[model samples]
Target: MRAALGLYLELHAHPELSGAETGTAERFAGHLEGDGATVTRGIGGHGVVGVLRNGPGPTLLVRAELDALPITERTGLAYASTVPGTMHACGHDLHLASAAGAFALLAAEPDTWNGTLLVVGQPAEETLEGADAMLADGLYERFGTPDTVLAQHTAPLPAGTLAHGRGPMMAASAALDVVIHGRGGHAGTPQLTVDPVVTAAATVMRLQTVVSRETAPSDQVVLTVGSLRAGSRGNVVPDEAELSITVRAATDQALERAVEAATRIVRAECAASGCPEDPDVTLVSRSPALLPDPAATAAVRAAHEREFGRHRVLDWPGSMATEDFPRFAVGGVRTAYWMVGTTSPRQWRAAHSAARPVPPNHSAEFAPDVRTALPAGIAAMATAVRQLFKETW
Candidate 1:
């Protein structure tokens, strides 16, 4: 517990952005090497991989992210982020520390299980590009293919609770950047030019109907415009307005329908406003929905019940939150990812009693109660991995 807490504090103090996690990678590599594992760095843009072989047994892969968000820290903790405009708001620091602790435990008790463990510290998970980059750079080829892949994330549930399900654990996601072009003109003149500001407003309103009217009520879909940029000054109209949107769905077909509907609405709105050209809709950072193998999930869930008891281990529904962890299952390897609660019991009770909202993951005020979460995370992860090995044995 002491070792994991110390590592978590150090990581939280010095948060790094995605694809720029040089120092974070070094720290993870150091921990892995210290545990007598063969370490490799720079796999796919600051990614680190550690391999430990105990005998002729099935290989299991465990992954942890090594990047932070661009938000500033507002938790006011003693070990808050020192880097400006960057924070571990998503609890990747907790993930790293827990994985490191699990690795250390396995190294210390070599006879507990006999299997090759591959620990991956991946970069750029926030942008949803890191997992593919590492795989393209030959992650499996260098480390050998694994029988199962395991990962977990932090959630707002009460600390010491574990959650998982059979299918669609996380949503498939796409990032869309749309540029609406118009002729610049004076704001005072009403009839002088095509007003893209008005067009962008209409586009936003119309997008809300795509999910409500166009798609079936049974299907789950979410389209959010996170960023918008228009004219620089209020007096003069700008030539173009830009919008950043994110789309998510439980299935690929539904995701495609949502994207198509969004593009059509953007183009039709721009055309109706008499713009010079159609709005440009560019899609990037595409990720498939995460569907864990049912058999693998069952085995891991049973392991958790044994380790933490049935009361602490809860059945979870699929979440709309998306991640790049599913990319590692591209080659048909069985994968299972779970979520562990980070909020303390006191905070959870206060939120309900005081009517105060709990700080969710990716919020600036999201400071995980590491005192309780870290130990549970380590135990749950290590127990799951050991269960996989025991089944193979």
Candidate 2:
């Protein structure tokens, strides 16, 4: 726990953005190396892997994301992010520290278990490209393939609580970059210009129907227009307006339908406004839905329950959030990814009672109670890894 806290403070103070986590990867690799594990650095764009061989047994891989979000730190903690536009708002710092602590603990107690512990510090998780990049660079071939893979993410639930999902853990997601084109003119000559700003606004409003009307009510889908940019000055009408939309769904079919509908709507809306060209819709990033192996999830959950009492462990429902962690299981390897609570009990109670919104994972104000969460996260991960070694070790 002491080790984890120190590492967490250091990581939180200097967060790095996705795809540029060279120093973060170095720090993680150094932490693992200090624990006597053989470390490998720069496996597919700053990905670090630490392998600890104890004896002849099953190989287990534990992964932690090393990249931080682009949001600036709003929390006034002493260890707040020094980088202006980078913050560990999604708790990757906690994840990295906990994974390192787990590695350190397992490495120290060599007799407690016997197997190969593969600790992975994955980069670019925020953009859903890290796991794919690692795989493309031959992560499994370079290091031995694992029999079981495990990972954990931070949640807004109260600290000291652990949550697990039996099947679908997180939704599949896709990002869309849509550029709506129009004729540029002065604001006074509205009759001569094909206004893309108006069309973009219309598209945003109509996108709600894609989820509410087009999709089945029983099925889940989310279409969010995160950014819409147009002219800077009020007097000048821009020639083009750009929008960035994110779509998430429980299944691939739903995701496809949502994107199709979104694109069709954007094109139709622009054409209806007498635009000259068709809208340019680009799929920026795509990630598959995360479905933890049911049996593996059960075993990990049971281990967590045994380690951190059943009262502290809870069953969690599927979330709209997506992850690339499941990509590690592409070759039929079993995978289990769970969530650890980061909220304090007091804050949880206040949010529920006062109807105040709790700061979620990606929020700039998300300040986790590391004092309680760090130890719990480390213990939970360690227990899960140990459980996977039971049959072999």
C-alpha lDDT score of every prediction, in listed order = 0.92, 0.91
- Encode model 2's per-residue lDDT on 181-239: one tens digit a residue: 99999999999999999999999999999999999987789999999999999999999
In terms of lDDT, the poorest run of 10 residues in model 2 is 384-393
Q: Model 2: residues >4 Å from true position, as ranges?
A: 391-393
- The true-versus-predicted C-alpha distance at residue 26 of model 2, in Å, is 1.4
lDDT of 2 at 139: 92
Could you give candidate 1's per-residue lDDT for residues 1-393 as a string of tens digits?
677788899999999999999999999899889888899999999999999999888999999999999998999899999999999999899999999999999989989889899999999999999999999999999999888999999999889899987679889999999999988899899588888889999999999988999889999999999988998898998889999999999998899999999999999999999999888889878999999988889999999999999999987788889999999886678898899999988778878898988899999999788988999999999999999999766
**Candidate 2 colliding pairs:** none
Q: After superposition, how far is residue 41 of candidate 1 from its true place, in Å?
A: 0.9
- How far off is residue 319 in model 1, in Å? 1.2
